[model samples]
Target: MKKFFTSLQTKLVISFLLLILVITGGTFLITNTQSKKALLDSTRDDMLQTVALVSTQFTAADLQTLSGFKAGDDGSPAYLSMIRRLRDMRSLSPNMVNFYIMSIAGNNISFVVDDAVSGPALVGDVYTDPDPRLFDAVAAPSVSDNFYTDAWGTFISAYAPLKDANGNTAFVVGGDMDASQVITRQNFIGTTIYYIMAGAILFAGFMIAIFSVTIIKDIKKLDKTADEISKGNTKVSVDVHRSDEIGDLADSFGRMVASLKIMMDMDEQPGDK
Candidate 1:
């Protein structure tokens, strides 16, 4: 056991294994972090694009009329038509959770148009959330950074502005996507990366084990040759053909044996002695 541990083959295998571990660990960490960031950023950009597309479906007049919409008045032709248009826009993307139009009056914001099924805020209900960023959506060039949560679920939201004929902001069109989907996708990617790293480590270990066996076999052959030469069997020759350090050692060993044989021959000659 002690000889096995001190063997060159064992040392080489251990060194390679440690190197693979370090490199694999570092690569997995970097790749996992970057992949998560990239995935979330892609999702955010898609949500923003959805907001922009949904905003275009409604004209300034449509937004202006919907701002005064009252709850329980779903029978109104204009309200029904607006809901149909919003649903159509929502259908374009499977990731979209909800699409709606909101009006900001002073510090108060109210829902203008929304699908009937997921209605939390009535048409005229005042939003009392402490977040002041909701008001910024009135003229927001792109999506709002602030997320929203309610009884329905947590969401990442985006908002775009609707402008009247006079270029005055009329309403803000917004869309929501489930935040859980992003989290789930990130988890899935991280797990896949971990598995790949683990597989690489295992394969490296297997190859190292195989290589160690071959090297140890060559070393044993050299040891046996040395044993034979020590016992005065100087005719024994090591047949190592590799072009490595082991091969060099074998060549040197062969030369020493040849020299020992010449010395023994010279001593046996009566005149030379």
Candidate 2:
């Protein structure tokens, strides 16, 4: 077993195989990481664009009027108008999971216009416990990057503040996209990368097998020639002709065989002339 491993053919094959594995593994890791980042960035950009489009549909006055009304007071003009807008926005894109308007006051949040028809909050119902990230979104000059989870599930949210005539934020418009979609996309990319890497490894293995066979064939020929030379046959010749290290070894062996043949012929002569 030790001899087998020490053979030139085995060493050559193993060296190439290890090299291929290292290269393929490193490439796979780099490609997988970059792909995940690109996909996530693309998803976030799409979310931002969707939020921008939705926010454009409402004016500051519309948001101000809606903020003055309570959640359950759907009969009010502002309330009804905002609900209609939310429904329209929801229908505009299938990816838009939730759309609503919110009012933020010093870490406290109150729902002004929630799309939930059956069990929506009342206008005065305030949520004192708010994620700090949510405050960052409310304070952001434009759309903010934030993620949150609630009864609906995990979501990547984009917030756009609605400003009154005096340039103060009257209310905030928010759009949510299910975080599961991003996760699913990432998983798909990972699977694809795995498949590609598997194919590449198999191809490298096949090529290496062919290369090892050629090298081993030449080495066996040299070995057989040497064995015949050991049995008193000095006329054996190694036919391998190349410029590589193996070729150089074959050339040296051929020269030694020739020298031995000359010495034998001289010894067979009658005597030293």
Candidate 3:
């Protein structure tokens, strides 16, 4: 086991594998973080802008009517108008889930009107689970810093204040959109990193195997030539063909063989005399 680990082939392969892993892992982490931030920032900005524009189309009277929060209020012109606008706004993009109005009463936030017809929450219902940002949004436009989940699955939301006759914030216009695409993109990136790491390991292993084998074969040739020359046979050639360090060593070995043959021949001529 110790010899196996100490072998040149094993050392070369292990060292290269570690280097590749570090490089690939670092690159993947950076790409993942940057991609998420870019996607989130771009999406959040768009959502905030869209909701902010929608707020301008309505007046204080339009907002005040939705406050009645009764079954009768649901039939009012302002309520119907809000629902129609919510659906129309949502229709602008397939990824849009819903558009709604949430009333801010002090620090408490609740639903007043929603484009969604069913079950997550309905008109006049206070959010049992709310993102704290909703309270801050009462003052101005704001967006979720990241994806959040509730009964409606995952979404990135934005809110903009709707002003009253006195120019005070009367309500908040909110938007919800699908987050699956971004999540899927991140997942795809993660999978791609695994594939890259695997490919790097395999490629490095193959190259290291070839490199170590070539070096060892050249060194063995020199060793064999040395042994034969020590037994008075200097005719054998060193047959290594490389342009690297191994080739230089082979050239040196070949010169030593030629010098040995000359010395042996000179000695033989003196004996012949």
Candidate 4:
């Protein structure tokens, strides 16, 4: 086996196989990344469009209409009612985890959860100045925005600026879905491709090993003949009949042994006669 590996032809075959595997692995990784990115981007767009439609029902102008609402009140009836409305809209989409309406000036967060697992601990939380990055990016433009953050445990969030009838940005509307959703899908795909490629490599290696063994056995015969000739036995002949390079090598070795045998015979005949 070691001798076979030392052969130039065997080394070339091994290198070619390795190169193929490297190229295939890189292509798989690139394909996985592109597919995952496209899926996440499409989901983000759909979520933002849903938020826009739902916002139509709960406009910035309607904030004043929500009665009995105080600026600093927590769990107030008006606030709870708005949260319930937000939760109802989110229930329509399984992918939507939670949505929040944040007051730009007061910095109060009013959130609604489709499920208790979604945002139970953050329903009526108030931050003095909630994560300035979120405020700056989410509230700057009226256009929908997307961002990723680990502050709230790795979430992919989309924000849309809300404008009242007076054409002023009152609060920022934001929604968060888990980032791991996309990654999970990618992992599954990668695992599947890995198994498939591994199987292919194993099959190809088995075939190559079988053929290499046959070639190596023939070469070993040639080595045996050379050992015999070196020990003063020059009558042994190689029986290789193939047209390959290994066969040509064996034929040349056989011809050299025949020539040596003739010379030995001529020297012995002179002494006997």
TM-score of candidate 4 versus the correct structure, residues matched by position: 0.67
Off by over 4 Å in 4: 1-46, 49-53, 60-63, 66-68, 71-81, 106-124, 128-133, 136-152, 241-243, 255-273
The all-Cα superposition gives candidate 1 an RMSD in Å to the true structure of: 3.5
The 10-residue segment with the lowest total lDDT in model 1: 125-134
lDDT of 1: 0.77
lDDT of candidate 1 over 1-273, digit per residue (tens): 348778788798989998999999899999999999888788878887878777677776686677657777666888888888888878888788787777777777877777636554567666665234456667764653545576566777777888788877788777777888877999999999999999999999999889887777888888888888789776777877778887898789878877888887787785877
Q: Who is ahead in lDDT, 1 or 3? A: 3
TM-score ranking from best to worst?
Answer: 3, 2, 1, 4
> Cα miss at 16, model 4 (Å)?
6.8
lDDT of 4: 0.63
Total clashing pairs in model 4: 0
lDDT of 3 by residue, 202-243 (tens): 887788778877887788788888888899886787788889
Error at 211, model 3, angstroms:
3.9
lDDT of 4 by residue, 1-273 (tens): 358658854875687578767877787778777766676678767766776666567655465644234455445666666777777877886676777666555445443222234445344345442444456534442322333554355666656666667766666666667667756766787787778778877787677667766786787788788888789786688877778898888788888888888888888788764
Off by over 4 Å in 2: 74-80, 116-132, 141-148, 233-236, 239-245, 265-273
**lDDT on C-alpha atoms for all candidate structures:** 0.77, 0.75, 0.78, 0.63
Please give the lDDT score for candidate 3.
0.78
Relative to the true structure, candidate 2 reaches a TM of: 0.81
Off by over 4 Å in 3: 75-78, 192-209, 227-235, 261-273
